[model samples]
Target: MNDLDIRCAAPSDIAAVLRFWREAAEGTSITDDHEGVARLISRDPEALLLAEQDGRITGTVIAGYDGWRCSAYRLAVHPDRRRQGIATALMDAAERRFLALGGRRIDAMVLESNERAHRTWGSAGYHREGHWRRWVKSVRP
Candidate 1:
């Protein structure tokens, strides 16, 4: 919508953001809970971006940078808001943030089973790295 407001997540917004993810996001992360998200906002402050329309969150994306790498996670849009350029607006904001921070490239994590997300990422100019596979070891149980 034309009234969409894109901004950083505030401490007050954690609860609503968690709820929004549960409703709009495709998959869950181990750190999807309150404490984890709170920690992120505390540490990076501006890494979590939200798109709101009339005070309700319509989409979200986490544009994280660890000094060297620019990574994107949790790019999600509300079901009712799909095909409305919300995701594109979010990515455009995220990429601008990364570029402003001197980031050369951004890597996005997309679920292999999520075909819709694959299409979305591809449309955003992200390509799969078929030569590499992700390896993960949870530091916390």
Candidate 2:
């Protein structure tokens, strides 16, 4: 297992986890959706798994299960930790959880421009589902 431990994230992990979400990769801080994260964890602790190695979260994935659609969202690995099997391990753990939750179909929405991420998910057995045009309307106007 590459000496990495996958486990459920606890309330105490909020700080370090947020840091990794914020500062890990350049231009990758688009993942700093903290309020969204808090809601997801509060709703489904099993959906948010942490990869701990030597006392640090090297990776994380927010797995969400809905009645009709189940998804693994915002799957991320610390920039320096990329290509180290961390992402794969995280996805495996999340998929297993999704299945246990009685999810039949799992989906991942990757930014089309991110070739590496596209390749990773593709190799991990997720194919191109379809193209989506995402229009985000800010709540605070």
Candidate 3:
């Protein structure tokens, strides 16, 4: 394997990213389309991180920080590239971004059904918060 290039997503990369997610990511999101991703990069240029190896995107993670919280989402690696430190590298980069932004802690959004993600996050020192459950409503226009 070659050295991984971890970088922010550009506007031109949105289409490729959506395609990559379809193949590599475990699940889908309401904001997985081109417009949503473009909005993300437009709003916060550094929030979306991509892992590239030999000119192909192999992994990705969204590291978003509001004034009050640091949220991580969309952590995915290519099926063929699992257990190869790509996810770790992406998380490391996200953690560094949060730390630089004065973030005290990180909250990652991992799907409950993804047992593989559970182990992956657990090994990264994240534990499930048994007391709290997420509540959400889609405000689509």
Instruction: Give candidate 2's whole-model lDDT.
Output: 0.78
For residues 1-141, write the lDDT of model 3, one tens digit per residue. Answer: 458999999999999999999999987878989999999999999999999998899999999999679999999999998999999999999999999999998999999999999999999999999999999887898
Compared with the true structure, all predictions reach lDDT values of 0.95, 0.78, 0.94
The CA root-mean-square deviation of candidate 2, after full C-alpha superposition on the true structure, stands at 2.5
| Of 1 and 2, the candidate ranking higher by lDDT | 1
Relative to the unseen true structure, what is the C-alpha lDDT of residue 119 in candidate 2, on a scale of 0 to 100? 86
lDDT of 3: 0.94
Residue 15 lDDT in candidate 1:
98
List the lowest-lDDT window of 10 residues for candidate 3: 1-10
| Candidate 3 ranges with C-alpha deviation above 4 Å | none
lDDT accuracy of residue 99 in candidate 1: 95
Summed over model 3, clashes come to 0
How far in Å is the alpha carbon of 130 misplaced in model 1?
Answer: 0.4
Question: Which run of 10 residues does model 2 get worst, by summed lDDT?
Answer: 23-32
Instruction: Between candidates 2 and 3, name the one with more favorable TM-score.
Output: 3
Count of backbone collisions within predicted model 1: 0
Number of backbone collisions per candidate: 0, 0, 0
| Candidate 1 residue-wise lDDT at 18 | 96
